[model samples]
Target: MKIVNFVGYSGSGKTTLIEKLIPIFCAQGLRVAAIKNAHHNFDMDKPGKDSYRYRRAGASQVIVRNADRWAMFSETPQGAPHLSELIAHLDPADLIVVEGFKSEDSDALRLEVFREIGRGEPPICQSDESICAVVSDKAREAFSALPVLDISSPEKVAAWITEKLQIKGIEKC
Candidate 1:
């Protein structure tokens, strides 16, 4: 599957952009999957729930299912698995949009998101050679060497991604 990693500092609109792009891709009948990297501890199951109780009661993995959907929760006390290892567990798709894993070296295409209003941090594209393009809320002439996309225009970004991957249709199941 084709992969693209969107990296940015906190409050840079990475998640918002991804949310907008998913539907655009889906509307075109492409199978799209996303992996979001959480920086802190998080829980998907609530307290008193069976899956939560099972996990707390020493079950290494707990799966909760219903007619509509299912979710798998696994303990990773050893440490978080590498991005590639995590990707191995997912079903194949036409595109995989990764929201984090900015520091890890990988073959996935990288797009750096930058917003000038918040964080006031320098763009990662300055130092990260793996970045293929940048999406920003402001004009970034300094990054003239790379393709710069407008943050408000997710449709253009989605089109760029589809063209880059040469995606024509959904992958066969």
Candidate 2:
């Protein structure tokens, strides 16, 4: 499986871009999975729910399921797991899109989303060697060495990803 990490500032539209790309990949018949890094103390299960109660009752892992789907919530008291560790838990897929973990030391390919929202900080791709491209609201000329993709065109981004990664989906035939 191939993996690409979308690294950018909080408001760089990483989530929005990923949301748009998922369906495109799916249409191409490629399985896509996403991993997002949430801030500390974030909770997925509602309080007073059975899953919540199990977690609160000292269960290290909780699996909640219904006819439609199932999710497993595992407690990691030792702090956040490494990207590789988290990836291992997911079922196999054609591509894995990771959000956040910009500072992670993994060798995974990174695509930096850049937007000029008055944030003085420079794009991480400027200093990060792992970044393969820049998806931005600006024009292509704004970037120096790396390829600059239009953020408004997610289809183009999706096409670029498949081409760059050499990932082909099922044949339409």
Candidate 3:
């Protein structure tokens, strides 16, 4: 399995890019999975629900079952694991796209959000060795020579990924 990552700050359109990319990858007839990292506490269980009640009762892990599906929610004090261990549950698919995890030193394609015209935050391209290319506002000035793509044009980004990774669909493989 191969791995690619998207990294940017909050409100940087990372999720939107991923949402668009998933379908492109899927249409390629290759299995694609994504891992999203959430820094804050979040609850998938509704309050007053049985599982929530059990968790409220101090259960470390709760498994709620039904005929169609089963989900296990566990609380760990150590926080999210590194990339390798977290993907154990995924289907042995073609590729895994990771969102967030900006600190990880693995190969990554960066996304830079240019909020205003002539705006200068040094662009994410100024630094960060892990960043391969940058997707940003459709302006060339905001980005250096490292390949600037339209942040809104996810198809182009998807195609670029395929070309960069030299990815042939699973059927082709």
Task: Enumerate residue pairs that collide in model 1.
Answer: none
Regions more than 4 Å wrong, model 2: 140-142, 171-173
lDDT of 1 by residue, 85-140 (tens): 88998899988999989989888989998887555677888888899999987777
User: After superposing candidate 3, which stretches have Cα over 4 Å from the reference?
Assistant: 65-69, 107-121, 140-142, 170-173
Candidates 2 and 3: which is better by lDDT?
Answer: 2
**TM-score of every prediction relative to native:** 0.94, 0.94, 0.82
Give the alpha carbon lDDT tens digit for every residue of 1-173 in model 2: 89888999988899999999998998888989999987557888999999999999999999999999999999988988999999999999999999989888876678999998797778887688888899999854445689899999999999999998899997444
- Candidate 3 at residue 58, lDDT? 97
Error of 2 at 9 (Å): 0.3
At residue 22, what lDDT does model 1 achieve?
A: 91
Model 1's TM-score against the true structure: 0.94
lDDT of each: 0.89, 0.89, 0.75
Lowest summed lDDT over 10 consecutive residues: which window, candidate 2? 138-147
Candidate ranking under lDDT, highest first, comes to 2, 1, 3
